[model samples]
Target: MTNHNLYLRLVGDRFEKTASQPFLIIPGRRPLLFSELDRMTGCVAARLLELNVEPGDRVMVQVAKSPESVLVYLACLRIGAIYTPLNPAYTTAEVSYFMTDSKPQLLICQPIERESLFDLSLACKVPHIRTLGSDGDGDLMHGLESLTPEMTVVEREADDLAAILYTSGTTGRSKGAMLTHHNLASNAEVLHSYWHWQDQHDVLLHALPVFHVHGLFVALHCALLGCSTVYFLSRFDTGQVIDRLPDCTVMMGVPTFYTRLLSDARLTPELCSKMRLFISGSAPLLAETHREFEQRSGFQILERYGMTEAGMITSNPYHGDRLAGTVGYALPGVSVRIADNNGNELPRGEIGVLELKGPNVFKGYWQMPEKSAAEFRQGGWFISGDNAIMDQTGRISIVGRAKDLIISGGYNIYPKEIEAVIDTIPGVAESAVVGVPHADFGEAVAAIVVKDGSRQLGEQEIIEPLQGRLARFKQPKRVFFVDELPRNSMGKVQKAELRDTYKESFGSK
Candidate 1:
């Protein structure tokens, strides 16, 4: 039997060959070397063992991003414990639901939140609780100086649960997506090779939050596999990104990062001349933003498509044409098809639900067997609720989520189509189209827009441009301008929130 623990693969040979090399470069602090990281994780692993955290035990973490928080994650992997990370911004009530759902044996939270969550932990029957601060001082680190490091890596099967990430509960209660060691390792290996990660040569600019897959797994795994250095920012800052762009070779970000960077005049082609790749994910990247970035930076942003269940299913080729609106082809060993609700495959160039099957797909939703069963078809293909179209060349273009499709007056209105036109207008920063309740039309098409500070625009200014471009029913029945759109922790626009805010836009019949 093979020890399929993901920690072993992540640190393969690097502990001896490049143990002293810098792994994380944090501003205003000493660089964390590979050996130092190893020792720290070992110490943390020893502490976890002391607390009786055994293999298969759930360890829930909800602390701000820090090197120590990352160490906790690595330590969980080292000891074969299931690591569950929640967004630090989640309120106590929100966390209460997750605590009840995950039922973790050990809970790690921020120092300030420990007191408030203590009673909740007690109520949830969590045996142990620890604290870890953003600045790396908390109960979790106390008394570590007196403990010996535990360097032993626990053995695990490929199918063993490694992590459980809760989906952003847009519809109902959030479901935990259970990821296995094989699911995580296979995706990391594929991405490392597909992205052309260069060992000891590539420097990654990591500004994403560690709680989500984009930052926690996709970005860190590739760097770890390649033994590369990372310029780790606490969060995405335009100035810090500009200052580091000349030194970093690769950058992974959400669409908001690019839009914010484009807002700054300091971002230039020369500043980004040394950058080898700029990848975007977690949310849809607008075509206008995509082309505008290339026009200014002299490099096309490689946009990939993925969800919490699957790490990364497809990506724009590293050495080929990166189309502005397409997410390129299915990665090697992954199969993708456009299908209807009945599991019948659709022809190319037609919009339909995206279904995929691959080694990287997660096992199932944790503790939700019936819900998990419904997400997959008889042929083992996971039915992704995203509406998409594939061209003859196999390039995938995501139209929108199926739930976001507005059926108004017996017509199907895809929000992305309206948003694309609205975004092209001058003084428009971004737009989100949603379906609001209507008395007669069943649901009315509505647009919530954020305007660029350069100009003052009216509702008609936004709605008038779509007269000849889109059908009358597709045009927004109501246009509302706001300072900005609501977003989740991962920067995806909260369309459900938008729908809720405008639910009574047309008034009851």
Candidate 2:
């Protein structure tokens, strides 16, 4: 396993031990065994080479979570081509931005996404474009049927580039985070060993979008490494999840997905009886939401923390007490610290920036050496622009994003503190708080809230609940009730858009 390529170690090395093991079950589709997946991936790898895709060439895949998507990803990795996956739901503008930035040689997409990719490819100067289904005429999957299955696996060193994941930047421009073979493979090994991943026993319910690191690497890699079965969901549906929970031992999702499942009345305790672990990530999990889930489901959600650059950095202990509202201790082989604004280390329990250094830290942003150098300090520590505090128990609590902080009347205010207070109120579903300009104070705290449509809660009603919980200055001076807060495809709150919309509302000094 150590001598072979990372993809080979994940898919081929585990093949003999679980050759006949069910590796995937696509609902109505037939279950694919480990040996079957390995063969199909080998065929796909041969197809990639036939297309003139050489080692180190970027291959961007745009598809929904299906067996084919997994095949495409693994195949590229096996052939030593760097894989970049984008959400099929991205807008034309977003697609163009990524295409231009990545400069990928090949773009694999579905029919609907192909139209946007094609339009973007022309303007972005991308050379090759391929789509799925027969209507596209020159689809990769269809074209591969003519080629003979090749067993050649391009050898890759641990330090070789494996994938490039693009995350939202502070300036609203997308920047690609470069991940190496060692970064991903090391994290997967840690997760597999520490979480007790077994080749024969685990069945993962993979409902999270594959565009994010959590879904693509952590969830999918875990199953591949352990030779476990993954039931991929095209999109998260609470009803579908409840129906499938009986067959799966592990399920991974974001906080919103868990909240939706809890809202669905059909999800009974009996439906979740077979699950061994329910993991949550990609966003902060509220303490109140965590409590409600445990009270109702009788299974504690094992909350893990990760980002687009690095894979799984930390996870709640698999055996110990899983604390509420905390992203448990750092995973084995990962080191984390709290740093001040000047890059000096901060004491525990002090709110400061989170810095991480480990085998999982990415190689850096693509084509942005200046910005990449700024992200790291002296000892290979990547400074995450997120404010956090490490408790005495070594648990981490993310307070708010560094850019999201609001300072009103010379008092520093964190939006997560206010959001948590408001989220506990009865009718409030979710909320986003940002700082708006004001003449008196340097800035005024403002909130945009989403409420349950069945009940209408006024600004006063929302403000009243947070009166005691938050300081007077921290309370939002203006509250706008919207049906839903604007979110990116990954369900992240687009605070920049909110700040732009209310710019005129805050009078000039």
Candidate 3:
């Protein structure tokens, strides 16, 4: 009777000790306690059973980050269904691709997305479709009506698939990562132990979207393990975050959140004093933004590293020395290494591809054995497509994405290293570096920068600072000013898209 899915086991453990703590809090809505979420999930599980939603059945949810969305995810886990969270911002085509590829038995979506999604569902001719939202006038809460169907929780196994998270796929087609109950449960426990999350004392502010790993799985799942209060946000807004600061103890966000917070006039030392920890991930944190926010708020943002394939790899310590530019050491139960092009282990100080092997590594890309095999090695190590260098002090600094490497005039250049230096400049707000075809150099370094002030910076002024830091060929030959860089849902720079946008300019040469 006590056994259920992976999520229920963990929740049962915490509820026995700390059930009265605030489990979830939305800005304008009432907060839910652990006991409330527990009851809600049970009701949802019972309803799912009545609908004959079997174990391993695919269930899709496309809604904003709210208590209902959170509850829906837990219900799927408690009853042994594979949860699929979709981006609310996805286009009809993008949504259709996932729906057709996964072929889920049921699709749950918000009101605004319902019409387009329903058409997609019918066009794809899926089996079932459900919509949520009071205004949408669909089967929103009707599915949660009274039901006490038998609990099939005991049949669920640790290796049973829990969720199928689709990669953002900014560069190419999206592939689903099959995360098992064991994979997710183990990672949650690892983060709970490594981050030292305890019950009844911490109030976490959750502002990131649920589609990404950082927001949905890492932060929310980790907070549930501790029975901490989750201050939810439908979407991230700097003004809203600053307003809630007086009561929140913990905050997790991406680099874009920090940049906006630093520019907000509402943030002050007194307002932020209530927070004990501030975490950033899903994208690299610029060193300049790190220093500026620290100087302004007196809290050094702890930057961590993770991906859709692996839940969370490394994090700057909560108590120890938190470095500004580095992503700190690998977390417990995880092994990280830097390797050369041949997959040989490189020296500690050298920059190379980063490889990880641990309990948190995903099973593999869903059904793509060839691509999956290429991503892994003879051992259990999963080769992340990221480039990194390890310092003597045991910190890992990401250089750039390996696929984003640019070759200019026979010299190899990493965009992240260049962007880092450009980010340090006073007038520059953001920058993206790419390679363009050149008749003379084979490819030339191209820079796209976003400026904050009216200061006009020429190509020479931008490339001068890198004279000694980079080789002559590695320096950018042309610099273009832009209002903003193209970013995906997770705020990651879409360099491939930029390369395509400027392909015509390269043809001029």
Candidate 4:
């Protein structure tokens, strides 16, 4: 039967077309071909069926970077299962919440973390637990051995949930953005055309985490759709990326990656001569960082705007002026407009709430019908919580975030979540979390706390309790003890004042 699965269509069909071509390469490992990937994912897909992971069953994978991780996702897709990926750094407490919410049939973690995750998975009532390491050998693959299973691709609808990516609102609790097969497929196809990629010949440098949409869906989907070869690295390392920069034709990274590259003297134009494009997203890139990278590397970084809800909204022209400080025009087939609180469209150059409607947009927030209803308008336009301004030329620039969430090093760090934990501490009366400018990370989490009476708390004392309570990236980098937090007339904590007051907290360091 012809495969209706999006993965089989985009990846498998293309893999067959380029059967012997090498599609993936790690630093020291042997190059992986399209044919090898087809076989590997097929084996994993058959194993998933044996485990009773039926169509629509969510498979939660929270393992370190590995080839098996990618295979697991493709396997889930081929079988019509919903794939959910969580950050490996998430603590057991964090894992429990996600597990309870998603109620997955299987929970997979790194082999090293199997001991700690055992009790949590049971508590959450997850049926099965599996292990996968960086090299891809684990209980899941071990159990699949010697069993010949069919590779029949399950038929799925366009609206079927492809993946559930967790994002947060002003509140701390995460809301899963249910991305459909159409949502992912259309975005990748649009990006393929917009970027003007050449199949099998274009080389992509991938360093972002597979858990996030930027890496898992956007980067991977684009590569798969274009049949581009990917140099998949575990994480963003300064020396590693720079050493391979000249060999790659395209790279997609956060602002942090570009800033780090600019710091190195070896990031010369000649070194990046082979690179055709460098795309930055996940956080706002400072205009200075954009110019400095261009002066140093002789290439203008293409900045784009996107969210977990909408795969990718707008991008700067690939051949035209790559603007600094502004994410360029809305993507083809996507409608972006500046609007007021009531969703009325505003004139150009006026900063307001940015809303968009397109096939690339997600279905809605998973399981929250009311919330899902509230975020959309009459004609199905989704309210993007970003504050943006549009120029006469239709270029869009973000001014502020209404959610007060911090995007540091390409990860979303919600302040209220951290503040909830801080407020519980004995000496802390109230706390406010804000992201301040940092040269390395686009923004560094800086927290301001007020003490209750004479109790004096050191920075480490305040930071100690948050170690296991929150993810390391969400924790505040620096804590400042203040008399009281600044507030407006409505008694709302004025985060703007706090940001301006501590803008230079990372300055000169």
Candidate 5:
């Protein structure tokens, strides 16, 4: 039987040849080589085994991004333990909910948070707890030199669970998405080829957080598969990214990153001359941002579409025309179609729910069998809950989330349509359109906008222009201006929060 462990597929055969090569280049710290990373993971795996962490046991980790934190992830994979990572920004109440749900045998948190989390862990019935700090000092790495390394990779079937990542839970309690060895491995391999990863030559500017799929699986996995050097950043900083752009070949980031870069005076085409690709995901990339980035940097941003349930469904081609508003063709071996609520496929150029079926799709939502079953159709297609349209050329353009659809006077209004127009207006930076409760219309369209600070503007200025451009029902009845919009960790606007904030906008109408 074959050992289908994800660790082996990622680092087994190429270890010796790439041992001395630089793996991670961190600012103000020594570069960590592939051999050092391997040794560290081995030691961490040995430590996990010492704690009696057997195969399939859940290992929950919530530590700040660092080389040592990554070692914990690789260590879990090495021993065939199901790795569960949480955002470091999650509150104690949120952590408690995850702990009670996952019921992990072992929990690793930051040293500063250990005292509080220790009590929480005991209350949640988690057996063991350890700490790993951002600077590589904590209980998890104590006395590593004396311990023997665990060099043997545990055997796992392709269908065995490898990780469980939770959703953002904007609408309700977050559901854990169970990912198997094959689910992650197949996606990584396909992306390695699809993105044209160049072995030993590509230097990746990795600024995205490691807790999410964009940074952890898509970015890191591709770099590991190609033995590429990564410029590991603690967080996304505009100055750091601009300084490192000349030395890097590829950068994967959210749309916010590009917008921030464009705002800076230091950004120039010469600074990004060495960059080969700039890929954006985790949130929608506005057509205006895409066009501005290309105009300033002399490179088009490759926008892709994906979700927590699936690693990656579609991507703009690496060697072809990357249309500004479209997330180009579905990946090889992945099937995508626009479908109605009943799951019947829609014809080309029509908007409907996007459904996908592929190896990269997750097994199911953890411990929520009914919810998982409800998300899939009879033919094993996963309902993506996203409204999208397919072009004649097979490219997919996401309109908005189904939950973001606004119904006013019995007319369906897509938020993206309003946002796109608002973003194009002079002195308007960005906008988020949402539906608020209204006694008359059931729901009334509302707009929350951010101005570019170039000129003074009023609600009338924003509303007057939309009168001719949009239908009366589709236009926002109320326009509210703010310095910025609320966003999640991945840079996605929190529309649910907006809806809640402005629920009484109509004054009990």
Candidate 6:
């Protein structure tokens, strides 16, 4: 593992091979080739040295996505410092928890949030603070311009910490998942071949936020390894994605992105004619949306499953059947199995907890030894906490989250199973199911829905479909309609907030 310690250095070696070739292509901005990015990252790395960032020191970056932000990550890697990225959507109070836990050597934030983040940094006693903006005008850029290019690569072992990504923490306080050089490098290498990377010919439609795993690790890692060009859009806009689809070859996104794009009349097969692959992850994709997208675009979506801890677990095969509901098989060099609650492996077709053993799995939760210990089994298998079933051919279909299971009237019910039925209903667009406290049973099932834009969908229309479809215990006891479901930055539904909002729906108070 230590042999490939310099992940960025290896990419730098590739950059040297393709120095003058374009690496990043923004719509209105000047594109940067491999050699230009090299000098820019070197300058940023020198500035990081000026800030006294030591090897293995953590640098918490909560800035908006930009090419300069990419330079910051590369700078950290070039200097062998840990690169910890935070979603710019994080408020000051939310950021305090991460700052307090990670205890980084430096803190970087947006220009507008700098005052608030600086105050928090002082309260937290962090030494250095800097600002970076989406349009590339900030103190960090000024600092970068003043420094001469320092073409030095710090040496780090493979197991040494490279970055710390905080989990979504749906249940409780967020835990930082520590990723090493090996963990990231291994996953990226496997994915390039697994996803059929097009080398210098590939152009990535990078509209996903870079703070999360999907954009930060999987997408960028593949592009950098392949020495590909990235069309780095600031955010995912349906119009922008459609406009750029004709110029790019690969696109990665959550299910929401596809649904929104499918809503527009601009998402025809001709619009995406130049697009070679459409990859989706970060949240579950509804089967209805999947079938509809295939019909509209004349291409099946290649959906993958991963978490903050594990980079890319299972991906639909590049050449084979990209099945509608399955996350396909485990990626090369990754071992995935179904296990009972007691940690015993279950046979295929049996519903149980999923366990994954792979190099892509993180080291552990930051500074939470006891909490981290409970997450892994004896043989290094990390309990995924997802309830899934494997078909005889080794394809994995996630039924629901284990924590999302509703035990009503002493019977086990999975919300995904009910939501799938609700989503396919004629007028329903999407749905989320959560269990809340109840006086009769331990918990009651509730469904929050968003209707298809064509018509107004009522509660009866939603509940009526589940009448014969699901068992009485599995059906939603109460239906709530909303214009949109609450989602995180990565587009996963905020079910914990839903449970909190409806905690008293069944007269718990």
Per-residue lDDT of candidate 2, residues 1-509 (tens digit)? 34446787677656787788778777767777887876788778887787788889999887666777778888888888999987665556567778889888888877766765686787777778877631323367775656677666788888889999876564546689999989999999999988888667899998777776888899988998777888877778878888889999999887767778878786667788888888987766667667878888888898988877888888899999888878899899999998998889988899999999999999999999999999999989998888889988778887766766564543446677678778888888998888876644546788899987657699998998775445476689999989889889999999989988886566642
User: How much does candidate 3 score in TM-score?
Assistant: 0.78
The predictions' CA RMSDs to the true structure, in order, are 11.0, 11.0, 11.2, 1.5, 11.1, 11.0
Write down the lDDT of every candidate, Cα atoms only.
0.87, 0.80, 0.77, 0.88, 0.87, 0.84
TM-score of 2: 0.79
In Å, residue 499's CA in model 6 sits off its true spot by: 8.3
lDDT by residue (401-436, candidate 3, tens digit) is: 777756443233567666776877767888898887
How many backbone clashes does every candidate have? 0, 0, 0, 0, 0, 0
lDDT of 4: 0.88
Give the 10-residue window scoring lowest on summed lDDT in candidate 4. Answer: 1-10
Summarize candidate 1's per-residue lDDT along 396-494 as a digit string, tens digits.
998867766565543335687678779999999999999876644556799999999888799989988776555476678899999999999999999
* Candidate 3 minimal-lDDT segment of 10 residues: 405-414
For candidate 6, write residues 408-450 as lDDT tens digits: 5434456766787788988888999998876445467899998
Error of 5 at 15 (Å): 3.3
Task: Return the lDDT, model 6, position 470.
Answer: 56
Clashing pairs in 5: none
lDDT of 6 at 434: 91
- Shift of residue 393 alpha carbon in model 2, Å: 3.0
Put down candidate 5 lDDT per residue, 238-323, tens digits, no spaces.
89999999999999987768878888888888998888999988766767778988999999999998887899999999999999
Query: Candidate 6 local accuracy as lDDT?
Result: 0.84
Q: Name the regions of candidate 2 deviating beyond 4 angstroms.
A: 1-4, 133-138, 405-509
Cα TM-score per model: 0.81, 0.79, 0.78, 0.97, 0.81, 0.81
Error of 4 at 330 (Å): 0.9
What's the true lDDT of residue 224 in model 2?
A: 84
Model 5 residue 214 CA deviation (Å) reads: 0.6
In model 6, how large is the Cα lDDT of residue 25? 83
How does residue 366 of candidate 6 score in lDDT?
95
Tens-digit lDDT track of model 4 for 429-471: 9999999988889889998999997576989878999989888
